[model samples]
Target chain A: MTYIIKTNNLTKIYQGKEVVSNVTMNIKKGEIYGFLGPNGAGKTTFMRMLMSLVKPSNGEIIICGEQVTPTSFELLKRIGCIIEYPVFYDKLTAKENLDLHCEYTGYYNKKEIDFVLDLVKLKDTEGKAVKDFSLGMKQRLGVARAIITKPEILILDEPINGLDPIGIKEFRNLFQKLSKDYGMTLLISSHILGEIEQIADTIGVIKDGKLIKEVLMEDIREENTAFIELKTNDVKKVAFEISHTLGISNFKILDEATIRIYDMKASEGEILKTLVVKDILVEAITRKNHSLEDYFLRIINGGGMNA
Target chain B: MLKLIKLEIKKFKLFNYYKGVLIANLGFIAFLSMIYFLERNDGNIPFENFEMAMNISSAAIRTTFIIFAAVLIVKLIIDEYKSKSIEIMFTYPIGRKKILTAKLMIVVAFTFIMVMSSTSLMAGLLYFAEAQFDIFPVELSFQDIVRNVYVNFFYALATAGLSLIPLLFGMRRKSAVATIVSAIFLATVTSTTSDNINLFSIIAIPVSLGVFGILIGYLAISKIEQVDVI
Candidate 1:
């Protein structure tokens, strides 16, 4: 497989504390790689290291086949990014901010600026300074600046931050189009699992400053491990029925009144019938396919079967 | 490198603080001219000797422009850190050293231009006043004019160079107040030294400070490529 971004045991240490510990991951071309982690989990640090905004204490970052260093500036021309929050010259208008960004990147096409502004829905904000912009507006302008140059790779650290729900949905579509139509690779970090689940081609779960798993979204979908969840009145009665009467061995009692049967061979109708016969009231029964949130939590909890 | 400098100039063209500084410099020249006119005849005034007048005027103008230089350093360097815009700039396809060099060059060059132009303009006005009103005992000489220009040019350069000391401190700490305070401190010290020192030492003091400031500036720039921006 051809990888657009590859890191070899990347590590960042601040004041002798490892903020990012030996993280080795790869991002393929034309794919949205979602970096999921809790707050202060080194997601921002790892992204900064890739951008060379922060020096890595150990390991190497390879972007588009070239190793990244402080002097590897020419290689950065192909990359666009927004680290942490979108920052701009507050005195400059949104348009001027984008113009300055384009000029710095050595790409000057006025039409491209207009195109990106329209793409990010910031076209009407022509005369207003960035200081007057709302958080959502600034977020949109930030996206506009990042995409103005039509870079080959985009590394966005919490790009959808401060956006409304509709704005988030719009950006999700925009990201998908950018990846599918423009063939741009993206490395995005976010706490929004559903959004990441919807857009990402691959997901990397990080915990305690270490990357615990890098799995393809497709693989996660295929290995979803469907389970039948039951909310009952008598949890012990249901558990006994599921084990002795139903002959189902693969099951877990989640709480006082909830049970999940992982055995795919067990029929839901038979399980319900046995529970009803035992005078156990089934309040809600749901057959759920494991979601990215589940996988993320499992990985974080150190119970994930695959890494 | 030239392109980077040009880009810096373009970026600052619309900056309000930059325009404000330019206007303030012009205002300062006018104020200084009025002071010279009002106090020309009074023994209490310090423009009794041609050399002393030139030194005092150059020192005053240099002090004002040095403050401007410090302001520029805060706007261009420290503000980048405060606003977190340096992260975006650092990720661009340009060397950090080049960007910093361009910003420092702008500060130094701006200080030189402002100080030189203001000093020369005030000097011309002083001479014009002297010719019209016979305000002082010592008449203006062509040689005095030439020496004043030569000495003030170097003085301006030194003042501009010395601005890097504040810039260094500010950039290291990413503090606007620190940068401004240091600039003011340096300007005051230099101005006091120029006033008390002999005529021969006027050019020597600022030139030495300028050269020392340049050394520190270069050291600061050299590390831009290696140090973490945060």
Candidate 2:
């Protein structure tokens, strides 16, 4: 498989401190790569390097088979981005800002601009000045501007930071649809783990300016490490049934009315039906798993301990 | 480069709030002409008064145009730097030096148009005042008028070039007030003190402009190309 983004021993130092230590990472074409790290973890720095907005102190960055450099204008034409905050002239309307971006990219497509507006659900705000826009609106306009040119690679840094839950759901759906249907390779950085876990094909975790791990989501899922939770008044009965019927006993009682079936595939409806037939009233049944959040905290805490 | 110029023009067309600068230029011209018209009607001041007023007004117009051009362009550039919008331009599929050159070209072109219009407007108002109030016995020759106008335009361009020095030095400082003060101080000292030096005044304007333009252009190209935009 051809890699869209490849970094070899990429490192950056500032004022005698290594802000981004020696690191290597690969992102395949047409893959949704989730970059997860805490604040000040050099994710933005690395992204800037990839876009040729910043020079790497050491090592190499190859994007789309071409070496990244300050003069890599041809390579930049293939990418779109929102680094740090999405800024625009306050007096300009949404359409005007997008039009300006189009001018810079030398792509003239009013239809594409309108399509991206509709995609980001900003169609109603065509004429409204950016100064009147809320933070969420500004962020949506940023995404619309970034994608208006139909770039093959989209790099968004905390794209959904100020969005509401509805906006986030819309963004998540849009991201996945764009990647799958439009064949766009994405490098999205976020501190929100649950969201990344849902859509990312691969995850790159960074801690203290250094990449700690890069893992495939398929491998994580195939590990069979997920747990299921059952809520009921008869916790003991459900635990017994889970152990007896499923033949698995590596479980824990979470509370007075809840139990966790560890690392097992317990069907939600069937398990509830079996418990109902056993005269055990189940309130709710949900899959419990070690979320990306849990894993991120674990790795960060581990790094702290090692330090 | 053309695309980058288009982007800069779009920015100007969309978000220009300093309409005051434009009005200030016209208003000063109108005020000076009105003063000349009133003086001519009353016949209170001598012919030397008309000459002096004409000289002062011409100098004021040139100075105002140069100041307006400098502040407006430098402010726009500095604000982009402060808000970090220059990063967007730098990462766009265009060379950094080309982007700077495009912006500089836009500003220079815009300045030329504004200066030309303002100079003509001042001349028109003065001509009308002269015709109405019967100010001086002798009319300025057409050739003399055109020559002076061109000279004023060159003065504006040279002063605009000089202003870029403080702008480049003070961009990272982020204080427009300080930049303007330093620029004024530098301009006053440089223009008035050519007496102590043996340098010829006729050769000084182009040489100074060339040196300053080259220096600022170099700083901008190097900085924009190497700035870490994160």
Question: Top model by DockQ, which number?
Answer: 1
* Residue A71 alpha-carbon offset, candidate 1, angstroms: 0.6
Tell me how far the alpha carbon of residue A118 in candidate 2 is from the true structure, in angstroms, after superposition: 1.3
Question: Where is model 2 chain A poorest over a 10-residue stretch in terms of lDDT?
Answer: A298-307
Q: Show model 2 residue runs off by greater than 4 Å.
A: A224-288, A304-307, B14-22, B34-54, B123-134, B137-143, B146-150, B180-210
What is the per-candidate TM-score for chain B?
0.86, 0.73
lDDT of 2 by residue, B98-208 (tens): 877776666565555665666666666666666787655667566756766766667556654554566665566666776567656554544442223311136576458
lDDT tens readout by residue for model 1, A1-307? 9999999999999999999999999999999999998899899999988888889999999988888877999988898888888888888898888888888899978889888888888888878989999988988898888888889999999999999999999999999999999999999999888888899999998877888889998998877788999998788888888889878888899999889999978788888888788788999998998776777787888734453
Candidate 2: Cα lDDT at B169? 59
Residue pairs of candidate 1 with colliding backbone atoms: none
Cα lDDT of model 2 by residue, A188-304, tens digit: 999888889889999898888889888898976765467788889988888888789777678889898988878456677777778888889888888867765676688776884
**lDDT against the true structure, each candidate:** 0.83, 0.75
